[model samples]
Target: MISAPPPRPRDTTFGRSTPDAMQLSPDIPTVELTSLLGGGREAVILHNGERYRLRVTANDKLILTK
Candidate 1:
C-alpha cells in the first residue's frame, strides 16, 4: 500500500481559498479596503514611521497622500 503525502497549509487571511485557483505566496499579505477604513471616508496609515492619509473622494474614488 502507498501512503499519501501530508496536505499543504493554506492562508485564508486574504479571503476564501479557491481550490481550483493558484494561491499567492504567504510572504505577501492582502487586506480589504473596507476593513481598513472601517466604514469611514478617511484613514491614516503609518509606513516607515511616516504618516500617510487615505481618503475617499466625492466621486467614490480613493486618494492617498503622504
Candidate 2:
C-alpha cells in the first residue's frame, strides 16, 4: 500500500479555493484588497474571522489582506 501526502488547509484566509487546488506557498504571502467594482476580479474582502483580506484579479488571481 501507498500513503498519500498530507492534506492542505482551506481558504479560510480569503478567496475560496476548491479541492485539488494549488495552495499558496509558505514563502509567498498573498496581499488582500479592500473594495472593487461589481466584486469580480480585482476585488477583496475580509476573512479568517475578520483578520485577513482576500482579493481577486481579472486574471483570477488572489491575495491576502494587506
Candidate 3:
C-alpha cells in the first residue's frame, strides 16, 4: 500500500516576539501603553541596536516597525 509523506512541523512563532520585542522586552511598550491609555491615539516606541519602533494604537495592539 502507498504511504503518505511525513507531516511538516508547524511554525510556533505566531504569537512569539521578534528581535525588536526582545530588545524592548521587560518594558510594556511604554509608548504603546501610553497611546492606548490616551484613547484613540498613536504612540511610538524607541530602542537601540535592534533598529525599530513600536507603534501602539488605542486598539491596544503592538506593531513593530523595522
- Alpha-carbon local distance difference test for all models: 0.83, 0.56, 0.57
The alpha-carbon lDDT assigned to residue 59 of candidate 1 equals 80
Writing each residue's lDDT as its tens digit, candidate 3 over 1-66 gives: 999999999866555556453445575754435544365344444566556656664664667777
- The residue-level lDDT of candidate 3 at 43 comes to 42
Task: Write the number of the candidate with greater lDDT, choosing between 2 and 3.
Answer: 3
TM-score of each: 0.55, 0.25, 0.28
Best-to-worst order by TM-score is 1, 3, 2
RMSD per candidate (Å) reads: 11.7, 12.2, 7.9
Q: Among all windows of ten consecutive residues in candidate 1, which has the lowest summed lDDT?
A: 13-22
The C-alpha stretches of model 1 lying farther than 4 A from their native spots are: 1-28
* lDDT over C-alpha atoms for residue 30 of model 3: 47
**Taking the tens digit of each residue's C-alpha lDDT, what string does model 1 give over 1-66?**
999999988764543345435466878777878999999999999999999999989987789999
lDDT of 3 at 62: 67
CA lDDT for candidate 3: 0.57
Cα error, candidate 3, residue 59 (Å): 8.4
- In model 2, residue pairs whose N, Cα or C atoms come closer than 3 Å (at least 3 residues apart or on different chains), thus clashing, are 30-64, 31-64, 32-64, 32-65, 42-56, 42-57, 53-65
On lDDT, the candidate that comes out on top is 1
